[model samples]
Target: MAQAPSTRLAENAETRKTRLRLWLNILRTARTVENALREEMRVSYDQTLPRFEILAMLERSESGLRMSALSEQLLVSNGNVTGIVERLVQDGLVERLPVPGDKRATLVRLTHKGEAVFAEMADVHERWVNDLLRAVPPETAQPLIDALTTVRRQIQQD
Candidate 1:
């Protein structure tokens, strides 16, 4: 039997079409960028994108990341982050130290190996971003970043 074509009610068609198009565009852009990042990470550092991101987060932290902080930053569960951290520690890329003020909390900091890997990772990450956005006029970059930040803040609001 032949499948019927997509049907839309006269009144709802345009609005639904606009929404569908927007979502499709978002998905496409996200998938493309994510794939590029993952490929870059795999080839350049022998790491996955999530692992690279986790390392970058720690690199930017002045005091280092707590397990809870890492969880939040990666949007993953504590169990997940714990395993990742353990692997990193075993690789001599990260150090788990006792948190001074909080006896119960442990701090996760990059070790010398971690710093070296992350510094190279950071360089590659920046280059990837720049290359991807090179077609976008430089003047639009700041406003684009601001817009995305605003969206993130709004989504994260209590």
Candidate 2:
């Protein structure tokens, strides 16, 4: 039998409320994890998350990324990346090179020192995340990952 308009409306309203609660819960969980990771990075490595992220990005690239491209990949302003890149350059962990034929563009790449440091950090970071999410079984997490992937695609479409 076809449902009445009032019944359908009530179901839709209930779903909307459930979605709002779910969104809040996800936000809270993400913030908690991020805070913990930030604290661990500071205490253990004397490093900030942004620095680690920059190194990780460079570590994945062979030839390296242009300054603007790195900023874009990180979803941050060029100014933000500039300061960090300057510090990394000073620390001898990263190097900046001129992009041939583009006088305005500079490419940033990990130095050998950076590669070694990031390798150690990556190992510890993985273990930390694994320990934090130890309670979530692979079977349960896989469905969540699938659902989130679909949500991400839907969001990008919007």
Candidate 3:
């Protein structure tokens, strides 16, 4: 026989609660990891996570990135990116060039010094992350990665 309406509703409610708990756990774990990384960056490099992220992004772009485009890629406001770029420029770690077509736009790229510094920092950063997540071996991590990929696809579809 088909299940009664009340029975189905109860099952749905339980599933909702389970999903909520999973979400909370994921959030907690992410925050903990982010906090640890932030502290490590500050202590070891005298830099913030955001600054590191900017450098990483710039490193990926061969010709550099437009200021606005960089902010968009980082999912941050232009003003926030402007401040960081200003500091990076001041430190001689990055340089800004005028965009050929758009006088209002500027392209930002890493200096040679910045490239050397980031190479060292990136090595240490990888080791730090590996140490932090040592408990999750490759076998266990693959399934989690697949599940998260599914969740991301579902979210994007919605």
How many pairs of residues collide in each model?
0, 0, 0
Error of 3 at 7 (Å): 3.2
For residues 55-115, write the lDDT of model 1, one tens digit per residue: 8888898679899999987889999999888989998988999988899888999998999
lDDT (CA) per prediction = 0.85, 0.94, 0.93
Error of 2 at 48 (Å): 0.7
User: How much does each candidate deviate from the true structure in C-alpha RMSD?
Assistant: 6.3, 2.3, 2.2
Ranking by TM-score: 2, 3, 1
Candidate 1 Cα errors over 4 Å, as ranges:
1-20, 101-103
Give the per-residue lDDT of model 2 (tens digit) for 69-135: 8899899999999999999999988999999999999999999999999999999999999888888
RMSD of 2: 2.3
Put the candidates in lDDT order, highest first.
Answer: 2, 3, 1
The TM-score measured for candidate 1 stands at 0.80
Model 2 misplacement above 4 A? 1-4
**CA shift of 53, model 1, Å:** 1.2
Candidate 2 lDDT for residue 57? 93
TM, every model: 0.80, 0.94, 0.92
